[model samples]
Target: MTYSKLNISTPSLIINKNNLLSNINKMNNFSKKNKINIRPHSKSHKMIKIAKTQLKYGACGICVATLYEAEKMVENKIKGVLLTTPITNIKDKVRLKNLFKLSDSFMIVIDNIYSINFLSNIVKPLRKKINVLVDCDIMYIGKNKISRTGARSIKEIISLAKIINQNKYMNFRGITAYAGDIQHINNYNKRSNEAKVRYNYLKNIIISLKNNNLDPEIISGGGTGSHELDAKSKLFTELQPGSYIFNDVEYNNVSIYKSNNKHFSPALIIGTSVISRINKKQYVVDAGLKAISADSNLMPLPIEPTPIGTKYSFLGDEHGKITLPKSSKIELSLGDKVYIQPAHCDPTINLYDKCLILDENKSIKTWNIDARGYG
Candidate 1:
């Protein structure tokens, strides 16, 4: 089960199962204690094993960002799926209908009359009713007014809901408002306050719906960065927080989660080998931009922190330069393995064929990044 026995070379992403399970249990318990449903987003891990673990840990369902993602989850026997994004095309409609036939419960987001009509038409002939959630735009508008985040306007949401209320082929579920922009505000208080504003806006909308005789069964929203805030907000009944299971550097830097000194253990890393050393103070690893993602605005953290005077930089397509101080005692030799914590796990994982699930001692257990390249 160890890495050496697996017969794989370096430059592979390794996942720590122990750390992953710890995060999953923490989020699951948090949701349960607060009386909220945990629906961790599957777009982060994209591994069936991880999805199964979340369900076992008490997740009511799993959330996906795309139809392709949902298709992969269905293959893994994931029953309840909430597609956070809108689906409009005819091919997607047909595919969704087929998925509905296989899945126990599936819901999609719709913003306008066109998408609502399209979904209704597709589901009508099959004698099936597709569950729909109104995607509320929760963007901050600077005057304490929250605007539509991505989907249609409030008017559009009500209009679509009215259409679904009358349609036999569609079931109006609830509302999905994700304020992703406020997740990493750097200040916990500021972020929480801003999230509250967004939450209140959605709550007001739900109240309005109730006054009109519409009962929202699902008020779903939240991301990894705002899970704590959203859970206590009393506005969200179901939380869709991804990235909590395997957090990246960007999420780790947030202020709320960062305590006096402790932090969430990063569950993913890219194992690379030193391919060349230009000088006593400088070296290069086999991993480059293609191997690791840098969208989080930081280079991967070395498993063992680089020496006091060392730094890493992307050299080109397939190489990374590590600069070291001349007086540093540590010297990296050719073929020596160094683990790198990627800045962003999602895109970096897509670049890999599979993930090497490792235990405390770095033993490898094959876990396919099965949903990779779904886009």
Candidate 2:
């Protein structure tokens, strides 16, 4: 039997087939037009099917946030997996060893020499060479105090490069300097300007590395917010943008391009059913903090009973409060399903074990979130 959105169970994560394909093609075309390798971050959607779609649309590889995510991709026979975070835990070292044995093109990001040594020790004993990138902090002193990850100075990066190169098991792939804080800045001019600063900073680091006889062929790191700027910089050989596949409310608010553009669309939604009606204007939904993520501080918008001025508020883990104007024309009774556009797609997706895949014909399928809860 064919299924539409109405047939899906409540508190389910849904992916719009048309919008998801549109998003994938847009980013793929954008990277192709710019001559950049798009390694779409798999951390956002964590589904093997979505990751495969990205590769089909011309993604060079997949970028994962955790080692477990990398393992999932490798298990699915996906090559070119890059772990974007530093792994220091001894417990995960064995898994890292197996990961290297599984995929021929696996790399890990590192900020300091300690992690380098940690990984080198494991790869050395296994008689394997692991590609590693230096994570550079592009934030300038006194400008952006917030630190995400990466080496603080060119000297330190150079030092780390020396150590990585000296080790027989480590292959210095390149540098990944991402200005993550500037990604969410509201103004386009401000975001672009800051990204330019980061680009210049990273360029200097690359120049220093070249001068030191160490060249970084893979200068990677960019998010959905800074893809345009990063692609134009001509500095990054690889662009890692995760959330472009499924734009969220927080991303839409600061989107450099308008949301109306078909390049990116809000394809992911949480389907919730009205469980209680307090009054004509207020109703409670079955999905709240547990079903939809609240980490972005933005509330999910009602898309089904999408009456103008309809607002959503989290009542608790299992309940959501949706309020409409007293004179609203749209009407809904208990058990009516309402689609909620998530504020943040990454953490929101992690909440669910599987997603209802909605196609253009209104037929639905299921895609397991293989990497969910692994990280």
Candidate 3:
């Protein structure tokens, strides 16, 4: 049905369907052209259909941050589910092994020998190996890998790979280095240079693995922040970009390209209704701190119920205020439908169970954020 017919409540998540598809295709096309495998992270949209759409657009697989997400993907028969985090506890270890039986393409990453041994023993009953990747610490900070994040040093990472290769229950796929700390670097030249160094460091590590006759078949870990560089770099065989599918205020503000990026448009927004007419320039909306994410330093950008350039600000947990241009002729009334693009898409999405998607015909569709709160 058309968006106008539905009684959508204030502070609801909305997705522009055409923009979503276009963003997906744009990233996919970029990956194909650069000879990099696209494994879009499910942590962004977290919807089963969105993940499926990604696969349909040539994503080699789906990367999930939690075992629960992997289970959901496997349960839905979504192939190539890669759990980016390491499985530590017995409960999750068992869950990981069970996932192996369900999906042949299911994969996990390891950062230590104990986890390797833990996973190997549990999955042995299945008499099959689970695809394993070594999580290399590439924070590129401190004196060495130990001082940084991830799986310590090059020696430590290689040792994990060696153990994986020795075990019949583990398939040593490759190493993964996700620079979460570096993805949001504001300066384009700085981000690019930093990524190049990290990729080179991983390259050396890859060479070391090759010298030991354990050349990796899959080197994963490129994020939305570094996808362009990641795609061009010969280091990562596959990239797990998350945010590009749904651009947020932070990602769109000259962060990746060092200039204003017109590549990806915001597909997600919070649909709110005007509740109070405070003044001509200032009015309160129903969306506030709880409705949108505050993790991002910047506030959500107003996109609807406006004359262009309307500004938004937080008023309370359940309220926000917007300001129109001083000289504007337009006037806003109570009960006006308002939409604003979030500053951070991932965590903001986790706050909701479903999103209103606007199709090409301007009709509204609802897709559940299935992986919400799946720890």
Candidate 4:
């Protein structure tokens, strides 16, 4: 249906069904053609419907960022759930024991020998093996001072893999290294080149692992921004790109979007209302720091129903201001609604408990953001 048909509260999270499905199909089509598996990251949507939809579109399974996310996926009967982060807490280790027992296809990523030994102790009593992968640090080391997780070097990753293989309670499934830092690089050539560098590094690691008889069956990494070159590289057995389903402003700037007859579009958005107006050039909407997330210090852009060249910024915790150009003659009255494209998709989606999903047949449905919070 249309935007006006979405009858919901102010600053509500909205999903365009056609756009969402198109994105899923596009990613799936690319992976299938390239002969690689796609494991869509559930952290972006964190809902049952979206996960199931991805599986329906031929996704191998789902990738979760937290233990809670894995629990929810297994609890709902979603199989082949891969925990991509190296969880450290003892309580979560305990949680993993239960979660593993529920789904034999469950797996986790680890980068340390201590984590392996600790998990081995936890899983010893279960009488079952917990599957795991080695998180490799593929992010550019010299590019930034702050570091991302994974084994810092190939030697360390091999050592971690060996420990996992030796541990009776753990099964060494594969290696995972997400270049998250490069996902939003504005230049396609630079992003592709950097990803290739990481790919070559990983290839050498695989050779080393094979030499040690620790050959991994799975090599998982890649994001939405580098999907085009990622599938072509023929390195990653399965790709995990979360934000493709919901094209946010950050992705809009960095990602090399294909605008053919079929492609991904900005499906997830915030619908806000013009609560107050300062003049013809400026107005206040109900969404702000609370409604839209500012994780990368990125501001939301005004989607249609709002004019072009309109700017949006967080005014306060509960409000956002939108300013128009000086020459613009458009004047929005009070109570008028505006649909905005959020800057960051993942955390912005977590702010809401439910989203208003609009269908092509003018149907408005609400879906719970099942894995919405830290819990």
Candidate 5:
């Protein structure tokens, strides 16, 4: 388990186990304080170990982005999977039925009457009731047009719920309005207010539904960027915060869950090495576009502080150029280990076969990214 004994040739991802467990506990405590259930999104880690940890910390269930993900999670015996995406295809419907045989509770989101009708027909034959959530998009489609939240509009959502209510094969769970676009709103007040607007919109819909004698048991939404805001708003009865377990560079920039005691540390890292040193002001790592994901605005930086004027730039397919300083104290020789904080943890982890679970001392234990290749 020591660093020297560990294999370092292949591109590997490391997860700080302690930091991960701590984040889970913190989120669980937050949910408890606010009287809400924690149904963390599984898309962030997509690993059985991490999903189990979330459940250990009092998660009511795990949320996934697709049926493929739910199938994999059920294979690992992770119960209570809530599929955040709509189930459309017939093949996927078969897979969902298989999952239902294994899991105690399952949920999926639908945005249209077609999906509802399709699910109803599929589930009716099996004589089973499938839980359904209405997906609402809060972002404008383009140029100030308020885009339809998955169910298209409030009226459509109510209609869909009524259809579900009428169908004995389908169960109307609640609405799932995700304001995903506002997760990284840099301005604190602006992000909070914007999220509030979306929350109020859904809340009003819920009120209208109740007025029509339909009560929703769950009002789920919010991501890592706005978990606290969603929790405090008293809008959602349960929160599905995913990235909070492994705060990445994108989330760290605008996170409101700060701690004076101990913050949620970045549990994931890409361990690369100095494969080639080009010059005094530039070097190259073994990782590049193929090794890590750089969709979060920038490339990875060295874990420790680099010298002044140092910069790391993506170079082609398999190289990363590091601009060194003139008076740099860093002696990054050939074969020196470089820990890279990934720009996006989810996709970055997906590229690897497994993740190295490390303790505080950097000792490693391997955990298979069991759901990595599910898609």
Candidate 6:
């Protein structure tokens, strides 16, 4: 169904198709030129259409954060599904085994021997080899340790690799060393240096693994913030940068190589309507915590009818306050729509079931968030 700007409903997620294509093409070209593989993370959009487009534009595979996302991708015939998180529970393991049987190529990350043993026992009976990548924590040490799921040291990483190589039902595909803390440092030089530390650690782990005669086919880990650094390091064979497809306000703050450039444009926004006016300068929007996420502690930026010097603030679960200049020329009626850029795209996209794909001519198409609410 085609929709014009005026007719679009409020509190709807909008995707500028032109900007989306531009981001996809730019990242794809970067990966090609650098001779590295991009497994664009599907957790950002969770739509099979975007996944297909990513693969069409030279992505080697798709990275899913959950088994449910992987199942959806495999069901749609998308090849090479990688579950970036490990499955520890029995029920999830059973589901993973089932997915392994159904998918042409299926993979998961393992940070410890317990997960490896658990996975090995389940797949051993089926005689099916499940591709496994060791998750390595290569980020800097914090006061209370970085709260991420991965092997904390080089020894643990190599030990996990050894277990995977020894398991008959598992294939040591590579390593995943993503620095969530360093991804949004807001300083290019410092972020690159921190990423370099992680890269060196990843290299050392690889060397130790090879010393034990274990060769990894793919080293997967990288985000939108460190994509350039990862590509330049020439260490990782596979790079997973999810949020680049839909650049949000959170990623917009990072000062990486192509971040400030037009290479990646903000394509995702929530089309909200101004419902109430408080005084002459302040108004309430339809989007709030329930509609668009404010977990990043940043308010949504107004896009459509973007008046200069307007500010958005979260009021409550069902309402958001926008302050406009009293002397501004932009007039807003009760039903005027205000498109807002989400602070964090991943979780914000999860709040909606479908995304409104705005075409180049400003028409709209509907793309279902097929992997939405999937664990």
Candidate 1 accuracy as lDDT: 0.78
Of models 1 and 3, which has the larger TM-score? 3
* lDDT for each residue of candidate 6 in 1-375, tens digit (9 for 90 to 100): 123255788889889898899999999899889999999999999999999999999999999998889889988988888888878988787787788888748788988888988888778768778888898877645323575888888778778888788777878888887777777787888888777777777788888888878777888888898889888888889888998999988887788784566447899988888899886778898998988887896667776465767788898898998888666876677887777788999999999999888887776789999998857
Candidate 2 lDDT over 1-375, as tens digits, reads 122237867899989888899989998888889999999899998889999999999999999999889999999988789888899899888998999888879989999878987988888777878899888888643266778778899999999988888889889898887777877886777787777777777888999999998999898888888888788788989988888888888887785653334336889988888899998888999998899998887778776546767889999989999898777976678888778899889999999999988887777899999998854
Can you give the lDDT of residue 153 in candidate 5?
65
lDDT of 4 at 237: 90
lDDT of each residue in 1-375, candidate 1, tens digit only: 223333457778888788888889888778878899988889887888888989999999999987888888987789788888888777777788887777758888887777877887777778877788888888753244455444545566676677777888878888888887886676787887787777777777888778767778898998888877887778888988887777776766776453423445688878887899898777899989889886767666665545554566788889987777677888888877766778777888878879888887766688888887855
* CA RMSD, predictions in order: 2.8, 2.2, 2.5, 1.8, 2.7, 2.2
Better of 1 and 4 by TM-score: 4
Off by over 4 Å in 1: 1-8, 140-149, 258-263, 305-310, 325-327
Estimate the lDDT of model 3.
0.84
TM-score of 2: 0.95
For 1-375, candidate 4 gives per-residue lDDT tens digits of 447525678889999999999999999988888899999999999999999999999998899998888889999999889998888887776687888789999888888887787788778888998898999887745366336778988889889999889888888898987888778887777787777777888788889999999988998988888777777777789999899998888887774643312235899989999899987778999998899997767789997766788889889899999998666777888988888999999999999999988888858899999998775
lDDT by residue for model 5 (90-196), tens? 76767777776676588888888889877776677676777777786666532244564476567877888888878887778888877777777856777877776
lDDT of each: 0.78, 0.85, 0.84, 0.85, 0.77, 0.83
Candidate 5 lDDT for residue 355: 81
Q: After aligning candidate 3 to the native by TM-score, how far in Å is the CA of 234 from where it should be?
A: 1.3
Name the runs in model 5 displaced over 4 angstroms. 1-7, 141-149, 257-263, 305-310, 325-327
